[model samples]
Target: MVSDKNSEYKFTGGNSLTGIHKLYHEVMMLNELWNGYGAYEVSYAAGKSGISFGGNQMDMHDNKKTAEKFTNILISATDNAGKHFFTQGEVKMIVGNEFVNLIQNGEVVLSMLGDNLASINAALSSVYGRARIDQLYVSEIKNGAEHIEKVIEKITNAAAKKFYDSDLGRVLLFDYHNQYDLKFDGRFLADYINGKGKENFSTKEMVVAPRDHSKYRAIC
Candidate 1:
């Protein structure tokens, strides 16, 4: 385990999710390691000084008599490494536009909901041996009621945008259709939702990859 001297560091940037995501993702990695499924390499640095290590399921087998020691090592190493990444001016986390607006259609949303849920249910049945998807879906909706309301507001705004932007989008669509003189398919309505057709109806944010784990070790 990393010593308290190494673990004691400062965080300057405020990311609503950065700390939580690191904690949760690291715990998930530990759980996978416990199940003999994953490995992690952790590195620590303070100014010009640094150290690194790694462990895997084989190490856990070697330390089964004192498994908590191994667990602490993994957790502490991850925590300290994350602290370095955040405090050394390496990663910048910016929170922007809590709510995004995009054109949406009720019918399209409903269709997407049905298609996505059906696919989810099928996969859940194969993996978990039953259909708990709808039950969990309802629970999420209840728990996230506030977020749901915000989503509704965004969707409403998007629907209004579709009406206002119809001319440009429609001209583009009409030109495409007229150029090909293609027969209408059911996809036309879905395409009409995005005007000129993008894969997903909503805009998406880009993600940045963090630095690689610098070192690793194993016991077994």
Candidate 2:
């Protein structure tokens, strides 16, 4: 067991271990994109995390059985200028189908937006034109901001409420924590590394390599 004094430090190590893995994957994707197609945003809406994409996506995939295990372990190792040091309760296990629900809600929102694109665009244009006119007459440029804000809030709140009332949203918001607590095993690191050495710490079969490496050349 990790001592209380060292828990925070241990957690930091675990966090970094997972963080590097994520950065590695992200860079790999960026490199691929750079080599082939020019920069472009993916069409995936709020992938893994609906409202906050970057914050939550980092943790969602790191806790898988096939992925690196860190959170539940009693001790963690870190590379400090090529030298390794240990810290102690640094394992983190996150469990929940939050990503799945986010995708479901995101799809609903996207579909709603697509269906009402014409009306939405018209309303936005109207607001912009009104604001521009108001600017010419008023001392402050924000003279018509309140009107536009209210209109936007009304439309956005309605759409958000629809998501909140859905079955997936209700379950994700209310029931996920209570029902899937076991899914996140903070002690997973300890369990996984019982007889393992640091050299064997890498995630095993985490990514399925291409069958024909030569055939998978970057389309530069």
Candidate 3:
């Protein structure tokens, strides 16, 4: 049986990760376009959060995961200067302040535009002043892109991973997981598959539009 690259994905159980892994790269390409490529990209206007850093726009508001994300990146830094910055524990304190600012003021505002490298440097200067780190964040967080890939891998693993068996399926599953964390309805999926009487489902057919979904949604 041949796999349909557009619709169906059949994983060959071997030393090949081409099918699912390639599809992950394809999805990440979209993220790169929207959230900036690599981990060094910073989003200044992150809605209510005020400042978002990293490739995937990890917000600098009361976001615990985002804080942890940066912390791990700093801890994993290869350079002595980068690794030394994390040990000082400034990122945690600054991120904690960001959370407090959000709670008290409803916004964690920053003067940084984060449009380019120069702007990011200025922002880091301001953040370093606040954290009293002597401006190490810029150099340290640049390592974020390298670690962000690992973060995406973890996200992919967390997303509804078992339902579909193709690249298309993984993409759809990741999108669905983004919307509804781990609320995968396996029973409904089995029912839908049985009702359709089809062994393989297409991305087009499998994806559930918000309006077209029932209470027991397969990819909710």
What TM-score, over all chains together, does every model reach? 0.14, 0.19, 0.40
In candidate 1, stretches whose alpha carbon ends up further than 4 angstroms from where it belongs are: 1-128, 141-146, 152-220
Q: What is the Å distance of residue 115 in model 1 from its true position?
A: 26
Off-target runs (Cα >4 Å) in candidate 2 are 1-27, 30-39, 45-104, 115-191, 194-220
Stretches of candidate 3 exceeding 4 Å from the true structure:
1-17, 32-38, 48-62, 72-93, 97-165, 179-182, 185-220
lDDT of model 3 at position 13: 15
**Number of the top lDDT candidate:** 3
Distance (Å) between predicted and true CA of 131, model 3?
23
Q: Report the C-alpha lDDT of model 3 over 1-220, residue by residue, as the tens digit.
A: 0111211111111112244444543453354224223224333543344344432334545555555544444434333233233343543444354444322212334432123334232332232322322122232223332333333343322132223333455566454332223232332232232232223355435432122223324643
- Candidates 1 and 3, the one with greater TM-score: 3
**Highest-scoring model, TM-score:** 3
lDDT of 2 by residue, 1-220 (tens): 0001211111111122233233332332232223222111112224442211111111222233211221111122223243222232111211123223222343443453353333322221232322322232122112222232332233223333344234333333222222122122222111221212223236542332223323323311
Model 2 local distance difference test score: 0.25
Question: Which candidate would rank higher by lDDT, 1 or 3?
Answer: 3
